[model samples]
Target: MKKIYVTLALSVALLLGSCGNKNNETSNDEAAIAVEVNQTTENQTNALLSVSGKIQSSNSADLSTRMMGYINKVYVNVGDQVKKGQMLVSVNSVDLMAQKAQVDAAIVQATVAFNNAEKDYKRFKNLFADNSASQKEMDDISANYEIAKAQLEAAKQKKNEVNAQLAYTNITAPFSGTITTKYIEVGDMANPGMPLISIEVQDDYEVMAMVPESEISQVEKGTPVDVLVKSINRTVKGKVQEVSTSAKNTGGQFLVKIALEKTDAPILSGMFTTVQFPITQKSDTQMVLVPVDAIIHDGQLSGIYTVSQSNTAILRWLRLGRIFGDQVEVLSGLKADEIYIVSADGKIYNGAKIKY
Candidate 1:
């Protein structure tokens, strides 16, 4: 009976020892979690935005001709600098010459007719005074004289019109520019209203960008602008010369023009560009911005997690402003020198542990 009592006492003591070990394990886990929460985290950020456009100028023209003729001389080749009123191309003058000849012949015929009528009028005047011509005959002769004089004037006017058409056969540059294209060879037919060449004046250059209508309010005429040429990776400063009053019907964008301050720019037309304007909102000019993925939102509250030293995350509340591209301006929550977490899988929490 004493042995049985001894065995029961040992079993009860063993049960108590097991419960104490389990309690110790649970307390250790709770302490580990507290230590993880205390570790501090950091985030570093940058400001970024995405906008694109093309470079252009206010003076570009598709030159054409007014008369149909064979191109006789192409004085200016592509890339040749021309002065205003410089003859660019000349058409064959043979047709114009023939038209002028026909006009001259008509003028001569009209002159001869006028002379014959005047001689007859003089002869009739002497006959009428001698009473050898009737009153009706004198009136008829004068009427014929007037008709001949009228026909001569009409022929002279036609000659002037032909001469004007002849001058149009020579195509001249309306403004000083470098010819970017020459569509016809020396022998090609010059058709009226067909583009002969494409030219762009060099002195005036501007960048063309399609900005959203919402941003138009921030830009105004004479407002300063910065144009970044993507082709050359160079930046040029300019001013906003024009802002479209109404939004485009198709895309709801407004056309913005940034007239560059003249440089010795070897920059050519039609390069892709980006124009940046100083927006009134501070977010638009924030120095430190971070990817949107780095920011977390709760109701109206904003925050980001800096991976704690213990490999867990501590949510830090933030004040955010304008959003550009995939980046957000961190108005308050982040420091420029710290590092923040960006997730690929998208599952993250205020206190979630992170590996990287």
Candidate 2:
């Protein structure tokens, strides 16, 4: 009986010791999950929205003719400066000049006929009143006078039409600008509505950018902007001059114009540029900032792994705001001074033990 009790006691002791060892091993494994985390904070940063575009002149035009004729002379060359109303090109006017001469001769002939008819009508009217001329003779004189008056009026109209045609032979500058392109040379057939020369207004330029429809509201007219020319390695300040009320056909983006302040650098038209629009939300609340990679996406919702007071990872869905470089603005779900997992291998889940 004494041996039996001793054996039973030893067996119970061994079983209890094995259970204790297993518990300790499990605890060690649980404590080994240490994840590097970072504390999130808020900072006042100027929110910037970047968009790429091209620099263009404030006013540009492709000059063309309305009448088809051979180009007689191209007075301005590429890179030439011209003033408003300055003659830029000329068309062959030989036919127009001959037409003008014909109209002029017609005018003189009509005037002479009108004068002779007027004298005859007055003399016949006086003879008819004195009963010396027949009624038929007076009627014929009156008809001749009327025909002469109509002819004179037609001749004047022809002269005016010919003069207008003659004026079309000369092409004048519509505005003060620099000639950037010449599409035709002397003796080239200048077709109607065909572009002859391209001119751009000097001393004024604007940067045009296409903004996504989601960001169009934040960009308003007169808003300040920063323009960067990558090729020239230059940055200049500008303002939002205009915003399109409608969307573009390609990508449903709205066009935004930034009028650049004049700079000494030779910023030519059609230069590629990047524009930065500064936006500030009018809110009395503060926003938190975190690394871009710290945020995780689950379908359409964004979330982040936050470290709880017990050092357990807890997933919290986040509402994000404007993105600033590598940092993102946390509009909600994350608070300032909260600890969040920043370097986890994405294996950490909710309620998981974290050592750091």
Candidate 3:
């Protein structure tokens, strides 16, 4: 009986040990399979991008005058709209009035002198014809008459100068715009070449952006750009209206003018803005259909992975097209409906059998 019990215990111990070993092996195999599955399905992705830019006016003017005088009345105040050639300020007429009066008196004096000289010349001509006056006497009278006529012409010129100065007393707008500044008040003395107000035309606006020479080939007239101003939370779009033929202050960047699409929103002039421009564009359909991974770059060459019929990942050369955000278009060497591997931790390689 002792011999039979010992044998039976030994058999039971061996069977349990074998069963435990099998279970441990099975669990490790299941875990390994799960990890492989997760690795093949993961992929990084890219999406569409939008451009950014600002708003600006094309016309502006500083109100000024050439003649100095007192301001009689300011016809337009700050924020007042004015048309081209419309009156803006009126100067005091005291000095201008005096000038006009002096010219008028001189004209009267010149006219009387001219009339007397004409009568004397007629008398001299008659006397010379009758030999009652000598040639020298007639010549002297002719010279006096010419002097009086010259004086009369000078008086007319003086009157014209006074009238011109009078016109300068009234200031007017040179272009259509709203008055953005008012530096003078009623009865303020105005000085020549001094600013009185500022007028800015808001109907036409333009945004200026500097584009680097490296990207000049991609920039052209009518290219769209976007602008954002946080002050008013104003977002606007604009187009490239001008591109400088010569470089600007930047090492090799050129000034580009983008005309904004007008808006009814109140946008203050000279507001600081953030702008963005797109160097290239990709279609939505092409970006959505392409794979996110398999892109590789070495030196100047860029390409991606391609799979053979046996599902082998091959490092094939490819030409890249437009880059839209995280996505890039393959211009050549990649066909539609093809499968490529995406990296999880950026560690991926050709001939790597990722069971997808």
Candidate 4:
């Protein structure tokens, strides 16, 4: 036949030269990636407002117990350090020492009937001043000397009400603190108001934060905030001491607090902060901000890359907000003048070709 048409034209020219070397090894205009771009800023300064807070201890408490027994002895433990009236917890005062031994046997039988009614009211006021006693016999011996001096002041006020219920079986420490939390343990039980131990006041910190009745009327009471203590990466300096004009109990937010100025940082109490707050922002309000090391997380999404006007590399994703220190608000895939990337020098993807 023509050698079978010259071997079917050499197998269609080696199948079109192996698809043109696989289209030049999958090219999407490859080689370029030398990135380091940036451009998205627009924060216009004075308009902070961060929020989310916690760091407590503007003198905390909890330490419950008003009379229910069993705990017998917990004596401080969770980080100890007590002091103001010390003695942390005791409880089993054997029924308040058997009711202080029945109020010391009714105060020794009312001090022997108040010394026999003050010797029969001073011998009936000296025999009724010489009438040898008789204005109805000195008014019936001055009414049995005022009923034995009111039963010896009612047995010394029932032994001062059993020594104030034996100081509630001892639990002490009302100030000078640092216990942090132990909620009863030496044989447990404790009930009247439960709690048992929590303490705090060690260096005085405070933050609280809630804000939102549409920005709690722009938070006022002394202003001056900053806080940001997200686990030791510190920031400190605060003021706005309390500002909750009602949010019916925090679900609608409101509850400010702040107060953390004198810090040698090492804050403690619950930690986890982020206050900021410098309000005032109306002049066209834009706010984009970006550099949290150029983001790009992945597990919970959050991306960045950008650049694409044919200079390629376009990941995008974003939707973040709040973290204005090392920069990071974006709230919707970037904008303020675009350009992103911030760092690269090689491996970047999506149509690749970068180059700034």
Clash counts per candidate, in order, are 6, 0, 6, 0
Of 1 and 4, the candidate ranking higher by TM-score: 1
Arrange candidates, best lDDT first.
Answer: 2, 4, 1, 3
**lDDT digits (tens) for residues 241-294 of candidate 4:** 889898897689888898888878887877788888887655787789887888
**Model 1, stretches more than 4 Å misplaced?**
1-51, 112-150, 248-250, 282-356
lDDT of 2 by residue, 1-356 (tens): 99999999999999999999999989967665677888887776556777788999999999887778999999999999999999999999888889888989999999999999999999999999999999999999999999999999999999998888777789889899999999999999988889999999969999999887877898999998888888898998899999999984747889999999989977899899878888664466366888888888989999998887877889999998866545778988988888888876448788887777
Which predicted model would earn the best TM-score? 2
- Ranking 3 against 4 by lDDT, winner: 4
| Best first by TM-score, ranked | 2, 1, 3, 4
Off by over 4 Å in 2: 1-46, 117-147, 248-251, 281-356
Higher-scoring candidate on TM-score, 2 or 4: 2
* TM-scores for candidates 1 onward, in order: 0.61, 0.62, 0.54, 0.42
Error of 4 at 116 (Å): 1.2
Q: What is the lDDT of residue 104 in candidate 2?
A: 91
In terms of lDDT, the poorest run of 10 residues in model 2 is: 278-287
The residue pairs in collision within model 2 are none
lDDT against the true structure, per candidate, is 0.77, 0.87, 0.72, 0.82
TM-score of 1: 0.61
Indicate which candidate wins on lDDT. 2
Error of 4 at 193 (Å): 14
